[model samples]
Target chain A: MSSILKKFLMALTGLALVGFLIAHLGGNLYLFLGRDHFDGYAKKLEEMGPLLILAEIVLAGLFLTHLFMALKLTGENQTARGAQGYADNSKNQSTPASRWMWITGLFVMMFLVVHIKMFKFGEREKPITAKGEEIIKAFNGEEAAKQFARESGEHGSLYGLVQKEFKRPAVVGFYVVLMLVLGAHLSHGIASAFQSLGVLRPGWLQCLKPWCVALAWLIALGFALLPVCTFFGIGIN
Target chain B: MNFTLNVWRQKNANDQGRFETYQAKNISPEASFLEMLDVVNNELEAEGKEPIAFDHDCREGICGACGMMISGRAHGPRAATTTCQLYMRNFQDGETLTLEPWRAKAFPLVRDLVVDRSAFDRIIQAGGFISVNTGNAADANALPVPKDNAELAMDAAACIGCGACVAACKNASAMLFVSAKVSHLALLPQGDAERVRRTLNMVKTMDEAGFGNCSNTGACEAECPKSISISNIARLNREYARAKLLS
Candidate 1:
């Protein structure tokens, strides 16, 4: 495919990921609504059954496409530099985020794996609560999973899983660091994606860059606040 | 004024380059950077030593021919000035400066401080001209070109095909150069007929020549001798996308 096409795909996937982050942050903010609301939100997702699975599949595809395109583009860029190393590469004018995008992206991917593992496998050593194990044992089939979902009292317990996950200082610290890196990446990325897709005017970028930086910080702070607040028992049960 | 120069020297494209230090003693502070090299070359030639080879056509900056990384900045510490226009007075009396050729895969080293930038020529040849026959000169304002477009086109047209943007770019991208060529033609009424094809062909040629993709890093704009703005690059991207969408 053409390089421009690859760039377009990268930008398209990036914009989609940014959209996903907004939805995710909004959903996670339901934690502030107290345990029942957050737990019901989680239960509602499982209740969607095949639809939720399909959406996750689409999200995974977007993530993979974004990753592959980035690797291919970065490889081409490095090769275009040829076999010489600059004696004073410091002179190249660029933002630190733009220069370090690949490294930050790889770290974000690593964090995603750990994050999904937290949800799917119940937080490594947190010891799934007896209520969680009872639900799992009680619901062996698809019909029972739905029946379990209808019983809101029984389903009100998954928030315990989130509470345990975020209450750990190590998990919270690592999550905060990754969120900061994500912010750095997005600060450059939001405007950069538009420029790459050829939709952004250069004159608009100056006005947009500050806004992109602010949005990045907002997303980072929003995601980070949960674990930080939870770890300090500020609104923790 | 005297200066210490660390000049890069390589026998050919296949050979590894190394820095060769020379003392340019008793040099005039008024001499241009290239002229200082000329005096140093004279001394080397008199001693039966091979003078360091470098590229130069017009000692004036407009030709876009004479260029080298002086002290890691394109065309020396003076911003917006070509190596040929850079004067020795810009350097401190006893300061050391390093000189090297444009280091992009698209512009391979010829020797010493010279690089073959014909990759740019091929990109120009790809679509830098309008093919329509006007046969003879029309009345001065026959085309009725818009003033702002003419000015923007002039800004892009000011590019002299220098590879400084590529040299300064960490990715060694040629986006600024290709964009200049595309925008210059695409902005003109005379070029309207082939605007779409021209953008596609020139950009394809640039990529085929192994130039890197623009990361929107702004390095090219920072170090361009002509002070070519990256807005032209934005235009190129827009044109390239428009072409693909229509195609």
Candidate 2:
């Protein structure tokens, strides 16, 4: 693709990913509402099997589009030669936004692979417990009464798996870090996507960078807080 | 005062280069960095040795003729200043200063501290001008540009075709240089006749020439003697968008 077209694809894919994050965060926040509500939400999503597949396909397409554009541009940037000397326009223009694109994009891609393996493909099916005794053993410190306190009536569902995962501090911490990286990536990616697409105008664009970064943090934090809160037995009921 | 210099020396573009150290004694603190180099060069010349070759035309910084990486910085420690404008006072006595030509694939080393940056010229040639034939232009008053646009154009036009933007960039991308040209010409009515075509062709040439993509880090602006804003990059994006869509 042409550089401009590639840039546009990057912008569009980035925007799509941001949109997905907002929706995903919203769904994940149902955990705060109550266990029954959250489990039902998960069940509904799982039931939309074909639709979820379609969403996944769309996401994959976007990722491929964004990745290809970056690769093409990176290649093109490698060959040109130019006249020597200090041009007035070039001094001290480097920014973090420009330098870390490939690094962060690659990091995010790596994270996404693991993220999909763990969350999307693995967890989508019925809760795959090694054994009931293993769950009980993992929760060994707590008696059966305490372990069953939240699950009470519902144990073999998505909510039970979530409660189990959150009970592990390591799992909660892992997600918190992941969310932070996601937030940082989204922060830079959002406004830049607009600029790439030609929708962003000067004068008005300044306000968008901070706002986008903040919104990204908020979304990531929203997803992260529940895992942490639930693990600590603070917000989970 | 005494200082140590780790200067990169190469006979030509194909020659293997390495850092050669030279210790200076009784150096004046008032001398500019280039002047300090001159003292060293004069000593080398006296000793019947080849003087270190670097590019420098106007010692007054406007020429954009001198840019070297000093201790990992494009133009030394000073912010928004070129090497020509740098003075020796910023350095402490006995400090070691490492100088090298801008290290990027696009910039081929021609000799010690001098790299061929002709890639920038190719990008300009691709489409960095307003095509107006001599003695055929309309009255300047015929075009009433917004005050802000005119000022911004002048700001972009301030670029002196220096490769400092390429040097300062981590990717060695020349987007800042190319964008300034695209934005400056596109800003005026006389240039509007080919704005879309100009932006597209120049940027296409820039990419074809192997300049890395712009990450918008603003390091180029910080190192620029002219203090050119990264805003010109945004304008370039706008121009590219229009050119892509309308043309």
* Interface RMSD per candidate: 1.4, 6.1
Residue B137 of model 1 has an lDDT of: 88
Model 1 ranges off by over 4 Å = A123-156, A235-237
Q: Which ten residues in a row have the lowest lDDT in candidate 1 chain A?
A: A123-132
Q: Any runs in candidate 2 off by more than 4 Å, and if so which?
A: A71-98, A123-156, A198-206, B134-142
Q: Candidate 2 on A26-139: residue-level lDDT in tens?
A: 888788777678878977987899998898889889888878877776665543323333223233444454556776777778878866776554542133333544566677
The TM-scores of chain A alone, one per candidate, are 0.85, 0.76
Give RMSD (Å) of candidate 1 vs. truth. 5.3
Report the TM-score measured on chain A for model 1: 0.85
TM-score of each: 0.91, 0.86
What part of the reference interface contacts, as a 0 to 1 fraction, does candidate 2 reproduce? 0.34
Quality class of the docking in candidate 2, CAPRI style: acceptable
lDDT of each: 0.85, 0.74
